[model samples]
Target: VNQLGIGNYLNFKDRLRHKNGKLKYVEGSAHRLDAQNIQVMFNDVTSRVVAEQQIAEERNFVFHSLDVMPGIFYVINHEGRFLRWNRQTEEISGYTAEELRHITSAEMIAPELRAKHKEFVASILSGARWEGEAELCCKDGRRIPYYYVVRHFKWQGEDCVVGMGVDLTERNQAERLALTYLKEMQSLSARILESQEEERRRIARELHDELGQGLTATLLSLKNAEEQMGESPMVAQVKHASSIITILTQQVRALSLNLRPSVLDDLGLVAAFRWYIRERVESAGLRVVLSVDKDLPRLPALQETACFRVLQSAFTNILRHAQAQEAQVSLRQADGNLVLVIHDNGRGFDVKAARQTALAGKSLGLLGMEERVRLVGGVLEITSAPGQGSEVRVVLPMG
Candidate 1:
């Protein structure tokens, strides 16, 4: 009223005690009618004021909920102005609340990803939900990978984007650890295979050089004894012993060759492969067609061993499980890599299930072949289905 007397009008809102002893809000106005008279009016506004207070309380609750969430949350306008953000946004970005408000969303993205961020925003604005991964650049220049999901909506009558981002640091670390462990396991397996080959070679040499020669000398002695004691039962017994000794010598020679074929060490991979196909595959009653590149050069010892072992394993599978009548083998050099493929017409098994079984340790032949190829930094692929034939393909780098 005092201000209205000096001026023309006055307006205000104030709380008052109601007749029933309750607090009420009022919006009041006063107008000076003349030098000595004034008009005053008061309008009840308790409902409007109470509703506004409730809305403010709810807004605060929502903000608190966002802050307690596990990941980064943020809201930005079409111009990329930060309208709201949670505690994680500031924490991960290494920026204070005030600093974030002054920067745009693109400013937080790594420079190389800023352009992509713009496209993501545009997509959201065009009414499509966006989800992808990007690197966030912190204030300290640290780049962190984050997977984000964003949507467009209206905030207080203004177009805005709301987004959530999850950190991928732990996931990436776990994957790296798994890869490292796998490599170590493969290296150990390669060493074991090398040791086994060495042992086999030693055993084969002993059987061929010692036991084989001993058996041959004994047979010669028995033959000479029979010649000296003619027309006697003792001569007949010595002759019989000579025949038995000759048979034993033949068996020993076969075992030695099967353990480690001397041809492999002396004549190289081609000779070894041809010998195996003729002596092993055909002897097992499986007709085989072999094609080789005439210009294929000799490979490193380990590589040649890996290739030969894989071939043996594949053919073993064909004979034991494929139930096929015929098989085909091919070896060639292309792009500085050795390519070997084997196919069989035998009844095939499910490749995926077989692989799973092999991985689970229920089967070792397939797994062993795969490990041999991997040890040499090569790739092995097996394809097959029930009622169809099976194929094993291997590619090894020559260098």
Candidate 2:
């Protein structure tokens, strides 16, 4: 009232006592009609004022909730201007709220990823929900991996993108750790397999050289004694003893060969495969066709050993379980890799079931073959189904 003068008007909102004695909000205007008289008008605005206050309170609550969230939450306009963001956005970016308001979303992404980020934003603005992983560049020169999901929506009648980003630092670290452990385990497995082969070879050599020769010499001595007996009662007993020793010698020789075929070490993989096919597969009544590339070069010792063992295991499974009549084995060099394939025409078993059984330790032949191939940095694939033949294929890098 004191500020108002003639030809001057003032507008204000004030609290006034209503007829019921409750306080009410009023919007009022006053104008001095003359120096001695003034005109005044007032209108109730209580409802509007209350609604505005409630909206402000709700908005504050929403912001507080977003700040408490673990992941990054943000809303950006189609022009990439930051409209809203959670506390994590500022914390992770090493930027203050006021600084973030001045920068575009692309500026927060790694420089090399800016183009890709733009494309992703465009996809969201085109009404497609997008999710992907990217590295976020911080003000402190740190790059943090994040996976984000974003969608386009309307906020306050303007195009906006709302998104949530999860930090992938822990996940990436865990993945790397797991991969390192896996490599270590694979290295250990390879060493174990190599040691096992070495032991087997040593045992086979001893059996063949020492035990086998002793049995043979013993049989020869018995034969000489029988010849000198001259129809005596001891002659028949000597002959019987010689016959038993001969059988024992043959059994020992067979065991030595089975343990680690001398041909594998003396003649190379192809010759060894041929010997095994003729001596083992054919002996089991399974007709086998062997194919070899004439130009196949001798591989590294470990590679050759792995391939032979895989082939040996596959054939063992076929003979014991496949009940097949015909089989085919092929060894060749293709695309800088040593390829070995064994196919058998027989009643095949469920490959998935067999793998599960092997995992449970009920079956080990399939697992053994797979491990041998993997130890040499190779891939082994077995395809089989009931009533259909099985094929085991191995591809080992020549390098």
Candidate 3:
């Protein structure tokens, strides 16, 4: 019956190849002796030979390519059962094809990685490609990192997983170590900045309270003596000397304040900022307003300093770049957050341009401000456009 079914194929193509042009195409099963089946059968036989050769060539190519890889290659059914593995898989997994075929995917992988592997398999079998890096236990119980690419496919009409994996244990470890070192360096930077700020506060306090007051008193005493002398031979010299000393004392006081304001320690962040705004803004010839929430709890030392430093930098920007006539600094607690806003009626430039200025050696002051805010787990937002004033807002999480 099988031979009868295809016997007409022999003459079908022979009628076209070697015989006269009396050949016509037919589509059913067998033809009678009036039309030869010899050509048809011969053509069908030739087609099968070519098809088999193409399949053999394709199989050879795939297997040869996989064999040359320095990784494991595998095909598994949707149920996580192995279908095939190349020679490289044996070298990597220490399991022969027969041995692997006897094992399920979970049996070869360690107990710990089994669940994750199953998840990957399930995701891939459901028509998604899975690509990932993971540590898997080898046949000798040694864990190794592998980078894998899994593709969903159909093998013999059944859903299957096909994938290749390269060992990445050494390179992956190097990257992890490098990342750890970088984090350590960053932590050291944060701590160094913290310590530097603490030391600055100490020095500023000493200069303001001890050296600053002593010089101020000395200048006042010299002035009094000059007045009492009332035209002595050295009166002119002493009067001139007293005025010089007074000027020097005031400049030194300003330097100390710039280093770290004593009011920041004595009166808390709000009062210190209030004095700062009044002096710095007025000195810059800008009208300034200060508002502090009436009844707010004391903030942690770190948070207060961060907030104050941000405000200080903002005002400095106003004086140096804003060229504004008025500014406002507001500190308040609303919705369980510390909100600080600095607004100025200045000639605002594009923030991107301001950043480029920092890039061009004109300080944005934003890096310092952002670093401080990030250190305290707070967020700082800067908004500005050309011809539009800048609003710097800081939202600090409260504890």
Q: Comparing candidate 1 with candidate 3, which one achieves the higher lDDT?
A: 1
User: Ten consecutive residues with minimal summed lDDT in candidate 1?
Assistant: 112-121
lDDT of 2: 0.90
What stretches of model 3 exceed 4 Å from their correct place?
1-55, 86-88, 108-137, 142-148, 165-175, 334-337, 345-347, 350-364, 397-399
Collision pairs in model 1: 324-346
For each candidate in turn, the TM-score is: 0.81, 0.84, 0.75
RMSD of 1: 4.9
TM-score-best of 1 and 2: 2
Clashes of 3: 16
Tens-place lDDT digits, model 2, residues 1-399: 776764778999899998899889999999988878988999999999999999999999998999988889889887788998999999989889999899889988889767776677778888998788978888998999999888998888887899999999999999999999999999999889889889989999999899999999999999989988897999989989999999999899889888889998988899889988998889879999999999788888899898999888899999999989999999888899999999999999999999999999998998999988888889999999999999999999987
Worst lDDT window (10 residues) for model 3?
35-44
Q: Name the candidate that leads on TM-score.
A: 2
Q: Model 3, residue 26: displacement in angstroms?
A: 25
Candidate 3 residue-wise lDDT, 307-340, digit = tens? 9899989988888888888888788898889999
Residue 101 of candidate 1: its Cα lDDT? 82
Q: Give me the runs in candidate 1 sitting further than 4 Å from their true place.
A: 1-62, 114-120, 127-130
